[model samples]
Target: MEGSRRRTTAPRARPAATRPTREAGGTAAALPDAGSHGPPRGARSRRGELDGAPAETPRARAAPRRAPARPRDTQPPATDGARAAERPAVPEPQPPADPEAPAVARRPSSRRGGRSTARQPRAPRRSRRERDQLMDVLHALRLRRQETCVSANTVNTVVTRLLRGLGNRESEFEGVEQLNTGSYYEHVKISAPNEFDVMFKLEVPRIQLQEYYDSGAFYLVKFKRIPRGNPFGHFLEGEILSATKMLSKFRKIIKEEVKEIKDIDVTVEEEKPGSPAVTLLIRNPEEISVDIILALESKGSWPESTREGLPIQSWLGTKVRTNLRRDPFYLVPKNAKHGKGFQGQTWRLSFSHTEKYILNNHGTEKKCCESGGVKCCRKACLKLMKYLLERLKQEFQELDAFCSYHVKTAMLHMWTQNPQDSQWEFTNLSFCFDKFLMFFIECLRTEKLDHYFIPKFNLFSRELIDKKSKEFLLKKIEYERNNRFPIFDKF
Candidate 1:
């Protein structure tokens, strides 16, 4: 037996590669395959207890005792039943048993039957972008200008005209008296809210003119100062009351209550809000009211001891500033209306129709009834008549009327150049000055010229400075003064 056991141990010592091939017909090969078929020792203990080697314990094998099934329909709902009755409380909900069908996910809850699902989180909100730096800068600059209030430039042309509209209306309120300080002034101040103690101090900047043709940038300027009642108050109140009347009356007369008049960008602000305290309203047209205000203040108003002319004539020559002259670009030969590109002639005809409609009508009776305020805006009226004259000149093939204006301007220039040698010679240019003046004055009287003639001609009369020329002009102007054209009244 010892020898046999030694042989068995000796065989096991050889590697399986050398001993266990089926070709060698070794029993070790059969042993290995048998071992593969059976479970390992530990695996058998786990599997066998329930399924393979060992039988189940009597306790585990014994079938569990299930309680009797309840009749669902006959049973009262948990809410209707007594607390802690037959079935403890809520029946636990069971998931359906089909594998192919999707399972409804249940949320956990402390209560026996309750379930709560979690909610999805929302995305975060984004912040808004800040305002543009340039816009903020501009706004700051404007506010600073307002705070400083060194802008006498606020009292524009129409402001002055509106004031003129108040001519003598404020005379009842005007009387010069020296008023005291703030506390003292306030103590004397009347309690009536209806009555405003008016005052206006316009520090009109000396008009700055770069050239005859440069268009400066539009300025939305404002001004402010303390109350200086008497004359200043009169001026301020006159301007505001007049301005309000001007705009309101304009809308009323024109029947254009809603027309925005867009080409005219406008804003009228008072430093002290309503009625009067250093008020300013501005409109930026190709040319604006400030220019007119300057003109009126300078050449149109009663003579000024402190200042000579309105800023209009002060900035530009009287001839250039007044609405007297025609647009040089809008020129056309007489009978030129029939040509292919005669916009000038057409423009003139347009003005002619507009003027006739405005001047001939009793009041707001013409076509374009919506624009009846056309008559009230002397500038518009003048502009219309201006074109009409051009049309009449083209229709008659006689633009010599305009030539006469050129001649008059040229004559004054020449007379100024050499005052001693200056003399009227109607023979050399038998477009005689007198005859030209005669036809020119007639043209001015045409419904087209009605609006612009008086103001323009008066300026000419006032500005003709040569003594010899003045004397000669006076002889022709014998019946008039201030170089006023005798023919203007006749026209």
Candidate 2:
């Protein structure tokens, strides 16, 4: 036991050949012996262990010999070839999943960082021949609708005769000239163009106009100088003119005038509340409905709310914009009866004359879309939008509040944003239409379709249209876009 203790306690002497040597700096350096120890300290073997280590306990032997990770700076520099060889192979992308496979199996793993592959199958694209056939059908439909459009000659003749009859019948309407307005006058009439709007404007000079509400489109008119023999004097309440009384008298006069026309069977429709027009139905060769509006044309400055409105300077140039601003504004005898207690009679302001002028002469270039100039799809786009709205209205009665006016407003805003005539080139019709639709969707999503003339007026009001109806329309439009307009197939 004493001898075994001495053998274990004594420091094992190294042979002379394997002894440590003292360097010139007096530092002793130990030379590694190949046979004495299996390997150097911390040097890993093929099995990833320190060679020649003492037999570990079961616990120590079971545990992994975790190598102290070297700092990145201390790591050996690797060659490109080495890195390439060390890298794990990336698998080739799999082909599109089998159509017959379960949807869950067909979907690519989200862990792979790819877009969702579980989208609804896209409709097969139509062939060129098929597309042409469809276009031919559309053209035929367009022609059929065009046939129903009221002839320009007929419209002018009727308007002239009616104005003459009105002047002769009523002294108040003696000098009131007719200003043709609406989509028919704008040349963007879609579907049946049997509807016509002619404003019988009586220039009310030296009139004090006050806005009835926050909306710039409504106003209350008062006479600054009351004429002694004026027939309108009786319609005035205190200092302000009563739009309701004036409209009532105007409608009575129009009814009497319609009875005088014998050659053409003209019948006056019953008056509608809040409607500004005295509707006349002409049944001659074809049915034509004309709305004769009574308006007090004022040359006064536009309302304060309109200061920031009509941002068309960049699109129509400053000179054109300035001229439009200088044009006379009109207030028609139209009032919205909110409730029984609503007192102040409101007159809706009209910019129809200006709107018609802008539509006819809408080119950034002087001769744009004219006889010799480049043709843009602006008018065609407007017609398509109007047709679409008409069709949509037939399908969804809830969308009745959304009309062509909203589409026109959106188009106006879109034009201002993308001012260049080249942007609306006929060749880029599909792309332009898609962009317009996208903009419309954005407006619907935000629930704020602003009136073009009045930015303050939100056309998409909860009072006017249901919020869910707007969302439903949005989804429908998106589906149409995604599926390449299957709705047009039915059309």
Candidate 3:
């Protein structure tokens, strides 16, 4: 009996090699001998122990309940090396739901350990594409600029002949000399060289200027002592020279002279209200508009209003400023739209001569943007701004009040603010253009763009651009900025 009992209680031999196998729930379970068709060792032992034990209590007899094992894909990733090998292969990591999600999701890989968190790929910056497009447009504009040289020559000939004819035919216009002005003379005219401005500068001696009301831009010009048989005496009302009368006679004379140019298809456009120019429409195949301005050349000191203006001392140097101030300023026969009897006689002050000199000699260094010097992108920035305004105005007639002069004024101010030539690098066109746009946007937002020469006179006052139009224009510009300026695509 003792021998039989020993055989029954004896310990069994262990398998040569035992390997762990992952069950359905990824719970490690011991594997049986390869050839054996039996339950695992743990299960057999638990069954034999249960059979020998006394009848258990309800708590002990009842097995603990377990929730079903989750699928391998549903489980959290295993960090343990051994468990990771036993677990089913995991699929490649997936991107977050939102593709346009912020950059937080795309953190760069960690460097401390070889571990890296999943990151979504990011979108490229728009500037690269924007730069490419801008370069292409500028190239096209350059090609078109070459085409305008022919028209410019033809227009110059017609203007020279017209000036000669006017001096010969009219006694009043005998001493008038052409002072070429506007974007054309500055060499910044874009799209087409269809517009031109020529000032008929008449010498006025012993003149006095009184500021017209609070507006420093307009002036009441009078002769200190009336000259006997002065050509301008016929147009004078009292001591004040009547801008309205002078402009009227100037237009009439221009009309009569335009009639004599039978070789060129030229006709005088009727005088526009509050405009100083006697515009001539010349159609030499393509339509060309020429503005003939009558200016009274003044050899006196500049107006008191311009004392603190120009701000070019730092940019053009103190000597340059002194020289520029020494030069004579001119007054044009430009009447205010809202001017009454006294105001109607007032002439607006002009700095076209000064503007031309500044533009021609524009540079921090003497030879900036010159043939042998560092070529800056100041003119390119100005041209782009002008083109932007032109394109915007064409699409919306509401922006007609906005003009190239505003752009020029803004650019001149920018030069003063960013005096360094490095700020306007030609190769950095996109960056420079964006800076200009942002500055312009800020001016529009504040509604406080001051006239370059007359700081007291706000060009963007409520009288000039109403609140609603300014807001609408602001939105359009912002939209263009955010969307990579689709309007420039037209170029």
How close is every model to the real structure, measured as TM-score?
0.17, 0.70, 0.73
Give the candidates in order of TM-score, highest first: 3, 2, 1
lDDT of 3 by residue, 1-491 (tens): 01101111111122223222212112222111111222212122221122123322223222223322343212222234344455444322222222211111111122111111113122122245776776776665562645587677777877788788878875677788989999988878777778889898989888998887778898888899886888889888888889999888878877877787778888888767788898988887889899989999888888899886777766678788888888878899887556233357989989998898888888887888888998777888888888778888889987877888988987877666556565565655664565566556556766777777778878777866787777667666656765677899986
Instruction: Please report, as a residue range, the 10-residue window in candidate 3 with the lowest summed lDDT.
Output: 1-10
Better candidate by TM-score, 1 or 2? 2
Q: Which ranges in model 1 have alpha carbons more than 4 Å from their true place?
A: 1-165, 168-295, 298-407, 421-491
lDDT (tens digit, per residue) of candidate 1 on 1-491: 01101112111223332321110011111101111222111111111121112333323222223212222111223343232233322322222222211111111233111101112121111111111221232232232334223222323233333444434344421121111111111211111111112121122322211111111111111113324453323323322212232223222321221133333344433222111122233433222212111100111222111122112231123554234223211100111112233211110101121122222331221321135332212112222223333333444433322422222222222222111110111111111122123222222222111112122222123222223433333223222211222222222
Against the true structure, candidate 3 has what lDDT? 0.66
Provide the lDDT at 38 for model 3: 28
Question: How good is model 1 by TM-score?
Answer: 0.17
Candidate number with the higher lDDT (2 or 3): 3
Whose TM-score is greatest here? 3
